[model samples]
Target: MKKHIILSAILLLAAALLYCSGDRQQVGQVTLEWWQFWTDPAIKPTIEKIAADYEAANPNVKINLTDLTWADGHEKIVIAFSSGTAPDIIELGSDWVAEFSSAGQLADITEDVIKDTANFLGWSAGIWKDRIYARPWILGTRILFINRDLLRKAGLGENYVPINWDQLKEVCYKIDSLGKDIYGFGSNAAEKHRLYKKFLPFFWAADGRIVSLDGKYSVFASDKAYRALKFYKELSDSCSMVDTQRRLEDAFLEGKIGVIISGDWLLKRIKNENIQLDFVTTLIPGPKYPGKSFAGGEYLAVSAGSANKTEAARFMEFITNKDNQLLFCKANYSTNPSSKAATTDTFFTSDVNLQTFVKQMNMSEMVPATPQWVYVEDIIERMLEDVLFNDAPVAESLYEANHKIKELIFKE
Candidate 1:
């Protein structure tokens, strides 16, 4: 009740401000508060330089930047919105946009974003209830990384990669036959933010979607979803579920795991480590959806509380424009540019492995855009954990999860 009251007050305040702005626009020195999550020592300086360049172009505008960490950034963002103190421009994970946008804490920038990101991928995540609330800032996709040496030692073909879920299971079991320490697959078990990411591709490839495209209802307990869960659960003997992607990547890099699905960031680490073992990248195997992968992207949104929304919108435009998008992707090699022109840059096309990531991105699916997703995902993850680790029947687990999701989306 208190939270609703606070959000109501914020919405009323935004309404009044929107009316006043229509009457008279503010004209003076403006400082746009930007909250971004690129806090790495290497990436932070690049973001700062972009801001510096934007400031130089618009002498009257100043960008006040705040650094956020992924560990607690979402919590901080929620607190900011609850307290009505959100920054003018804030960076959000592709998955986090729906919650804030649904709360009326984010400004509707649909026209502006559609104009700028016509060629952008993963726009579905930023659009909620048919309105665009955020613009795609950076995009990335995950691919299967194979340990070829491990495959050879397991007596499997060195260059062979699984093309379907059944093939993947067979390969995993083959690697398991190699030794006690060697696992066929590295999987994320019950990790909250990540488990769904690993599971969704299979769910999607099975021709099952979690919710309707319009975000109207739940559609999770389909035969395809049940089969996907059953298949994943069956691989339990040959797979180990780690709690974090870093752990999964580490196990794979140490040659303890034969097959792992990970992002392009892992590629960067592999190049840096310069390991002697030969590894290859390929699309994640799927049944009905052959090469499905998960699409992830960063988004920039303007807060409804911003007194200078026009300026904030311009700032976002400047930051996400093609030139700056290219620059950002160059500095951050793990991400692919969302723009058509930027993808053609030699930075992406010249590399055979990076090109695979691009293909995966093209074949990937964004998570559902429903506001209920935030809560529903918890239910889905718990259901997956129950099925995978607790021996819960897949059909029963998915059916119960669908019930929970329906309640979340339709409850009064």
Candidate 2:
């Protein structure tokens, strides 16, 4: 009888201890679910290390990272929000932020990030209706990558950099005259999501705006748009190889193409692989001088339905801070930190090629922050296809595209 009583008491004590331990864990611990799209084997380790460091600093906080792919991340995020199964934090592409912000699926983080706006770049990418819903993490811009050897062979000095459209045309034509196998310009083909990026810089250079600030109407059918399209079509036809961005970059690397508008990824590839190609980076030549290019990057946002909003916001801010951004950008090697101070570091300033990209990034612009931007970009791509491939009149294509975009924006 005594043995039975003692065993019962011990059992009760063990149960009580277990209960208290579980309760303590529940009270003191916080886990934040972060869904991100950095899946590269080389880069994922850096992300993991950063998360581990953050966890070590905050002992009670845990980061639950979920890797996502660009191919279907948007669709997964939409489903998560609709089902109320969204993670606490999400890494969104610059173009995807509007759809989530407009749907009220993203937490309003203006108060958390407003004071730091001056310290960071590309805030326009994260702001919706004057309210910031995300923090820009890494920024990137497209610049002109020129083959120095091709320029020299064409009788243009190896040091020559085209600063205006006329000079660029002359160089391109001179290079194209070299041979049938070698092209002058690497023009983007009818790629669904890509052709618009290549074409928008020209449109923007000509002072074209896609939609009004209020998002009430389309302002894309102006004389500037028509002129930009006509010029782009002429340039492409005269001395360019129409291909996908990947093929274009490959051609540039193989020294088969003279000039292409490419981003930092190609720069990193060349440097890392020690390619023995003679190339220089320059700002995209415009009608008069260097013009605006496309600026876009990764953004971090807190989910509106996340129970751990405060913790998620803290982690978001921490990861996007200057030091962390520099670390991540350095590891990625193909992106610029969103932090203004981070860019001033010797990592970027010491290299003339990187400096060109930084300069272009400052002059770059993002697409309009509208929820219907996906459809709008589709229309823009189709319009370019019509003019470039179908030989449709530039003005007629612009007018039709403008009408379609207006209907998409103001439809009842």
Could you say which candidate leads in lDDT?
2
Off by over 4 Å in 1: 1-28, 239-244
Task: Give the clashing pairs for model 2.
Answer: none
lDDT of 1 by residue, 94-136 (tens): 8888988999999999877666655777788898878999988
TM-score of 1: 0.89
Sliding window of 10 residues with minimal summed lDDT for model 2: 328-337
lDDT of 2 by residue, 1-412 (tens): 9999999999999878977887878877999999999999889998999899899999999999999998898899999999999999999999989999999999999988889999888898788888999999988899999999999999999989988888989989999999978999999999888899888888899999998767677899999988888888888999999999999999989999999998999988888899999888899878999787988999999999999998898998899887888788888885578888988988889888988988898889999898888999999988899899999988888999999998998888
What TM-score, to 2 decimals, does candidate 2 have? Answer: 0.93
**Candidate 2 residue-wise lDDT at 165:** 81
Tell me model 1's lDDT, rounded to 2 decimals.
Answer: 0.83
Error of 2 at 312 (Å): 0.8
